[model samples]
Target: MVDLNAALRPADAGSLQPTAARPPARLQIADVSLQYGGKTPTLAIDNVSLEVANNEFCVIVGPSGCGKSSLLYLVAGLTDVTSGTIRVDGRPVHEPGSDRGMVFQGYTLFPWLTVRSNVEFGPRRKGLPKAEYRAIADHFLEEVGLTAFADSYPAALSGGMKQRVAIARALANDPSALLMDEPFGALDSQTRTVMQKLLLRVWEHTQKTVLFVTHDIDEAILLGDRVVVMTARPGKIKAEVPVPFARPRSISLVLEPEFIALKKRILGLLHDEIDETH
Candidate 1:
């Protein structure tokens, strides 16, 4: 929690602003469903309701064919929901915009643009003055440890570095939320580990709300404030497990007795869900 007493502002100088002290559920999904063409008609998701509080690190994990990525798309408004509602900051999500920054697993950085240019893309599209772009882009790049290679092309960087640049680009605009769909799924094992550390550091430095979609159980447990496990197909949330560990956790946290116990429980929950789905 931010120390309100130490935070200075002109309004606080003279009067008190009446605001509820809650992280606030910035993203809310209620009885949502998605349908697509298939012989059996893939439901994608059904009756799924979730709320992500401000600053919460939420990870959605399930089996391979589950609708995790579909859920992210629905949140982004990249695809329309078949039913129910999606809201962010208490407003219904209707279309894609910079209010929510998204990082895809495929590393969508423009091959034509340099890393610096890629990071600046969002700010530039906003028509933010060039004077402001440098600092915003540079700041996030530095956070991702890409300041030295700001001018390097994405093709020239390692897989991990490329993903970091993508993250910096998403964060440069300082969006109210970050939506990620398995953003590190394409990397090598070592690179994925490094990227996970980078993601934690970035989340620490900039406490934007994150909703990450991953199929990896270990990854979900390692990063999520709350891990939402869903059923295999026609997905539905099966369990929501709070990590219960404090922030700045180490990789060794996985080996901790409590962490291991929770992991086993979550696995059993997911197993039951998977069987029901199949």
Candidate 2:
């Protein structure tokens, strides 16, 4: 382990370069909490903290009404955190900004706009030149395998296809973080599986930081680099599980014994949390 004399020789100026430490976390949620207002207020989330490394796929899984989506909204800057902070690259998140993109469970595409136009919407609003937005939309459409459908309206596309457009639209913005809230939860099992694989492909290609929320344990395990499990309503992080599987994962990997074991563990904890909520 000691080659200090050789290291000190450094004869080639072109070959020697200092290596810096890895950058700080790309997204950080520090002691965040939230509440819904009314005469009788409801606490939706409680003292949650988590981090996603740059270009990591981090999934949050929990039982129904666990406030997973609520936390996502806070990160997206669509809602305010009652306490603590949400930061991206060390900048505090206060309001919706172009730095983040969102894909939701429902297909949030504009029925009136064509697929390409829908993807172009964000850049257009930012007043980027037409050619630039056109290229941006086209590139992401191709990435999502939707290039051929670029001219079609949302009303004419299948649910899966429309969601693909939603993903493409989000990515077209070149956001630093991609926030997803059960984006495929509504699809049938078969379609959902296909969408999951497609999403992995796009994720590999783009390498953008992702924070995805899902109640599906299988879905969580299939995609996350690390899975953060939350307690039932008034949710707080109950556990954090790192998925040790290699990347470019496939649906078949779900059948592996190791995968099954991890799923069982997460499911056991999640089931306990659900029972506690009841």
Question: Candidate 1, clashing residue pairs?
Answer: none
Candidate 1 whole-model C-alpha lDDT, 0 to 1: 0.82
Model 1, C-alpha of 104: deviation from truth (Å): 1.0
Where is model 1 more than 4 Å wrong at Cα? 1-22, 38-40
lDDT tens digits by residue: candidate 1, 35-92: 9976877788888888888898989988877799999999998999999899988889
lDDT of 2 by residue, 1-278 (tens): 22233222212211112234324578989888898899999999988878788898989988888799999999999999999899998899999988999999998999999999999999999999999999999999999898999999999999999999999999988899999999998999999999999999999999999999988888998998878888888888877766777888989988887778778888888889878876
Indicate which candidate wins on TM-score. 2
TM-score of decoy 2: 0.90
Q: After superposition, how far is residue 137 of candidate 1 from its true place, in Å?
A: 0.6
> Residue 220 lDDT in model 2?
90
- The pairs that clash in candidate 2 are none
Most lDDT-accurate candidate:
2
- The clash numbers for all candidates, in the given order, read 0, 0
What are the candidates' C-alpha RMSDs?
A: 8.3, 9.0
Give stretches of model 2 more than 4 Å off.
1-23
